[model samples]
Target: MNISYKWLKEYVDFELSPQEVCEALTSEGLEVGSLEEHQAIKGGLRGLVIGKVETCEAHPNSDHLHVCTVDLGQGELQQIVCGAPNVAAGQKVVVATVGCKLYDGDKEFVIKKSKLRGVESNGMICAEDEIGVGTDHSGIIVLPESAKVGMPAAEYYHVESDYLIEVDITPNRSDACSHYGVARDLYAWLVRHGMKTSLHRPGCEAFKVDNHDLDIAVEVEDNKKCPRYCAVTLKGCEVKESPAWLQERLQIIGLRPINNIVDITNYIMFAYGQPLHCFDADMIKGNKVIVKSLPDGTPFVTLDGVEHKLSHEDIVICNEEEPMCIAGVFGGKGSGTYENTTNVLFESAYFNPTSIRKSARRHGLNTDASFRFERGIDPNGQIYALKQAAILARELAGGTVSMEIK
Candidate 1:
């Protein structure tokens, strides 16, 4: 389990350093494999700041290069040569000033005064991947306009040297597999040690989601394998880039930001410790889902585009026409959402632990959902998680809840 210090802050307001938290968790039975601070890489990010592109023009000597003058809120504007195709005037970007060192994996890169095809560059403009915050190396990371030009890039990008605690959770410790689970346990340990806590306990137990009465169908063929399955149907939802706050939450946790439809599911799972999957409603054949056991040798394509042959014991969530997902595992490609998808259906359920575990191992596909399911989750609490996803879908994706499925 990789738990981010910043993510834990969202749940608990403890001022303990990452190392301290790791120590506390270790003392409480959760083994910490290692603790690493983001700043430790590349000897730390210093002399990097949020910058505004004052002007951007094509390089005279190279067609693919752009000469950019950036305002760092200082007396002099710094010139940078950028090869990103997205650089534009009036954009907020990362400016790695001279003498700053950035790392890509173990390789060290130093920003300095140099000429890029005859253009004298004072510093280097950076992307998320360039500085290690994310994998988006397509272009320079554009900060929100509210970012102060002179703010430290680490602060602006939230690199605050946050630590990721790599924990070794035993399979029997299913509840501690997620960040919230870890926080909850750590909070307990803190209280037991006579430390004060401002942490709100994980609230999904009584979490309320407004019911939108519409129409959907769900059938669990084997009640023993799938105790309960809930699907939240949405209509008129707009799948677009998530707002900055939502995107930041996922990005800081090292999850790639997709469209709002996908990101919301990821965010809810990231925060609530309940794994959820969203399917494009329009793509769901007959607007009905059936949770059942498929025949052995059934071929199905998961969202990753990998075709897996199903065993007779495999549990699947099928639409009227075909299997939409390997229950408590991954979604199928046929019903996945895309940018143009306006309606969606999110599934939250509890699957038999041993059943999911064997199926996951049989197919050589272990996912976050499978891991949690195989270890067992709060079966009675899944409806609440389903509703939370419903509420978020309405708020973030401009969707109206159409119905509840069981």
Candidate 2:
């Protein structure tokens, strides 16, 4: 498990350095294996700024390259030769100025004055991948007109850094799997050692139900296997990219950011140690969810596009028509949220650890959610995490929260 040193401080107010934090956690049984500082964007996007392309003309010597004059808000126009097929004038974009450093994984390269195809180039127009934010090399990232020219790209994008502490967790210590969980232990230790620190958490008092516009009924076939289940429906949500802060939080902990709907679920899971799933409500045939086991040799496709045969004891989460997820383990391919997904059915459930472990091993699969579920997470936190996710979805995805928690 990876814990962010800065994120951990958000909960426990300790005056410990990074090395001291590892020592403290090691003494508390959450042995820190390694500590490394992580930058959300390599080099923190220093020396990069927003620039407006003033003029774009084809390079005289190159067929594909274009020579452009860009306004960096520095009073003078910079002449740059860009190779992107989509480069055009009058567009606001990211500019890596001369002497700026960019990264391709661990490798680093510096931007300097150079000649490309006999045209003098001063800087570079950046693609999403070039800035370490995303993977889109087809074209440069275009900014909205509201973006301020000459603004530092780091400030514009709110780039930040944090320390990642990789901890080795034992199967019995399931409670320490999340950031809050680890903070709780640290808080207790601090109190015991006469430190005047307190534990703080992100408040969920803001969670409100706007209207019962959508309803999803849930039925559990076996209560013993699933002791608790909580769900909420969100309507009119725009599934798009998550905010920069959210993406940074997940990235520091080594999780790739998906869309907003899926990212919020992942954020909540790591924050609270509760695994949540989101399904495209439009794809659900009956607006109902049923938790039950399918027959032996039942074939199901997961999000990874792999088909797995199921045993009779495997618990499945199904809509009125068919199984949508391999309950607590992995989600189905078509039933999950997509780019056009507007309505979502978010679920939080507590499954039997032994059952989840058996099913996960049977299919030769181990997911983040299943890792937590198989080790026995807090059953009581399901509704709390569900409410937190709903609150985030409504705020970040522009959705209306459902009144009923099925």
- lDDT tens digits, residues 357-379, model 1? 99898888888788888888877
Please state the error at residue 273 of candidate 1 in Å: 2.2
Q: For candidate 1, which ten residues in a row score worst on lDDT?
A: 201-210
Tens digits of lDDT, candidate 2, 184-235:
9888878988989999887779888888878878899988888888888999
Candidate 2 runs further than 4 Å off? 44-160
CA lDDT of every candidate: 0.81, 0.91
Inter-residue clash pairs, candidate 2: none
lDDT (C-alpha) at residue 200 in model 2: 84
lDDT of 1: 0.81
Which 10 consecutive positions of candidate 2 have the poorest summed lDDT?
Answer: 201-210
Best by TM-score: 2
